[model samples]
Target: MLLGCLPGLAAVLALALCAGGVERSVAASGRQVVARPAAAHKAVRPHIVPRSVWLDDDTRHAQPPPRYDDRVIAVFVHHTDSPNGYDCADAPRIIRYLYAGQTGSRDWDDIGYNFLVDRCGTIYEGRAGGIDRPVTGAHTQGFNHRTTGIAALGTFTAGVPVPKEMTDAIAALAAWKLGLSGTDPRARVRLTSSNSHSRYAAGASTTFPALAGHKDGYMTSCPGAALSALLPGIRETAARLQGRH
Candidate 1:
């Protein structure tokens, strides 16, 4: 009984020491000294998108079953494929229109993208699930699971100048989202294709940039040429935000 109690006491002592870095110091007089406070690790939280900023209270819909993945490892950038000349003040309305179109006309359960960014760099929350959760989206057909979709709120065909602010916000958002799982934005990750509509057959494993373009997974020229061209820089900026050299 004494030996059994000794082992349990030792285990508790070890746990307590590890919890807060318990230290032992000796003074010149041979008396035990107290430990100094340990420094805290740096926290890197960027702007977290609020759902209220984009989701109107009246955008009523029936609740669909939620889908989620283990974690997010990739980000796919896209363009809304709508006109680019609208005033920034009308962004919410435009987003609502897009949401309605996708849900009502296209019959999707909800807006596909995980997030949306305007030309002015304002980030808006998309989808009906929690932003921090790995909510499986319907944006990129085969690569929806374990990934995030950020749609730039405009048509960005070739020669259409992609806004700097938009890309910057995208980088910040990507950094925060990827950093949550300690994923390197500039790295390549292999994901199994869930749909054959993608470049690879269903269940084929493929390697792609952690920050990928919509076209990388599917044949459609989504995200458009201008925005796609900006993805490399976005990836680099996101990595830097995550403190990657």
Candidate 2:
């Protein structure tokens, strides 16, 4: 009887040892997981919109590289004030034409807007400055500093049909650009007026929508009445893209 009981005891001891080993292994794994850096668990960045540079026929140059602002807190939407009827394939040509007029006729150092979008929903890099940097644009009169300018390729006066593709692209661009600074696209930001040309006096601080129309900061009816009407929808779309839904 004693010998039989001894064999059973040995089996129990082996099972207990196996259980202890498993618990130890699990504890070790937990420790290793806890040792990982906090940054390793950070959320992934949001999607970035694709953009194109100057086309083959496009003449792109900035004699003196465009100046840069510290950061962009707002974005102003505009219309190129060009013809609305054109083939999407000819977007590059259209852009080249605009560039020539600005740099050649206007004698500006570079294109005014930081970005341009075609009716086909294509986004183009403008202004000869680094797209990711806060390049000061010549688009807005007094709100250039800490702001970005995105021009829609065609005219959008009152009653003109605004393309869904164009508006969608604009929303995407606004969301991504503002996300770099952790700005909420639906929020309002206060900016100091740099010139008296705009509605506000120079050095006067005023609050404006994060995603604004050209006319929001200036007296010109740029971006058109048709496009201006879409600003609210664009802001909502941008905010949704930034995870603010």
Candidate 3:
């Protein structure tokens, strides 16, 4: 009897280990069932360098408390329109320069973009808000609310080679951020225009790609033709990263 009981005990231990340490219980039918762990629906957040890496106390501007929305349903992609030949080592310096220009010349309270990606595929936290929150950015004039802005570090005009690393980083960032709200990157989201300056008049309801170029909501040829052409692929990649079939 002891030897038979030892075999049964070994089998029960194996089942527990295979079930990932979850508890097992008997079902109404009298069959033992293993309770598996719940599946994770959210994507893993990608690595992002904090604003302090680039902005120190001396350069930090005095801005109002970061504004937030209910959730981030869309993302706007943009190009800095700056030089593309910058070394990755100088990315922090370049970001600082852009911050100064936006705050000094443009008179903006802080950097407009919620995040920035360099040519070397490094992601940097922009603005003065928490990256995980749906911070209202100033990148898109009419659709700033309920959206996040990601600016590619350099210019990407027609015929220019958009770095693969940069695009991959953007996709990863989008997958995680949009995944927070269970948003599909390939889906079209309806956004109400807050400013009349956009392509759509103020208060107009329009549908745009969840992952869109800055030009989609605005009149400017922002993000340039080269990067604009890559939006579709980026959307698909982001969806895949989020485990969408």
Candidate 4:
């Protein structure tokens, strides 16, 4: 009987080795590569954020995202704050910004973020999910395991202020997303708050990562001076949503 089971045991041992190797491979690649959505497949959908919620209608939406996705990490905020005006009237304008202009040679085909928050505080949606699926995009520098993007208006370097409504939108969206991840069967997420240092901070990832500034992880200055300064406040608002406060 013992010899009869030897082959099965060997097979089990081999399988375990393969599983362990895969885990290490994932960690080595970092969350970004593993979490990024495959560009070959994107859904056809539009998620629009009205102007009342925006501080200004100066930003555009990108192409749709995957039909169904759920792995999101931290929220990355930046100041499109571009002096050069963009189409901004609607999502098509956004698609132009992401695909046209200096595509950074990547020809990404869409905006680099998952969402856009304007000066007025209204949130215009970007990166639609595929056919009732979840969505993911490129925004955060690293830590894409469960990350989303939020681009604001005006240049903090140019002396722009991060408004109260902007924070409100961030909190509202973060809360909504966190709750969604917990219940959404389509999205297989692992985090809830902002905890990624590459994207958030140490305490931020308690459940889900916290809202963060683009400069937090990247060397280039982005999200603007005023908005970057408000990272903590944004996180607090999100925390309150989860009863962390």
List model 4 lDDT by residue over 155-210, tens digit each: 45535556687667766665555543332212222343223334445344333334
Q: lDDT by residue for model 1 over 118-180, one digit each (tens)?
A: 889988888867877899887787788899888887777789999899999999888888776
lDDT of 4: 0.45
C-alpha TM-score for every candidate? 0.80, 0.77, 0.83, 0.54
Put down candidate 3 lDDT per residue, 40-140, tens digits, no spaces: 33578999999999997777778889889999989999887777888998998887877776676556788888999999999999987898899988888
Of candidate 1, the 10-residue stretch with the lowest lDDT total is 1-10
lDDT of 2 by residue, 1-245 (tens): 00000112123221110000112223654564223222211112333332344534346545695688888889989887667788988887776776665666556666677888889898888776687899888777778889988888777878999999999989888888887676777789888988787788889999999998878887667788899999999988888877776
Order the candidates by TM-score, highest first — what do you get? 3, 1, 2, 4
Candidate 4 TM-score over all chains jointly: 0.54
Global lDDT of model 2: 0.71
**Which of the two candidates, 1 or 2, achieves a greater lDDT against the reference?**
1
CA shift of 39, model 3, Å: 8.5
What is the overall TM-score of model 3 with all chains considered together?
0.83
The lDDT of model 3 is 0.80
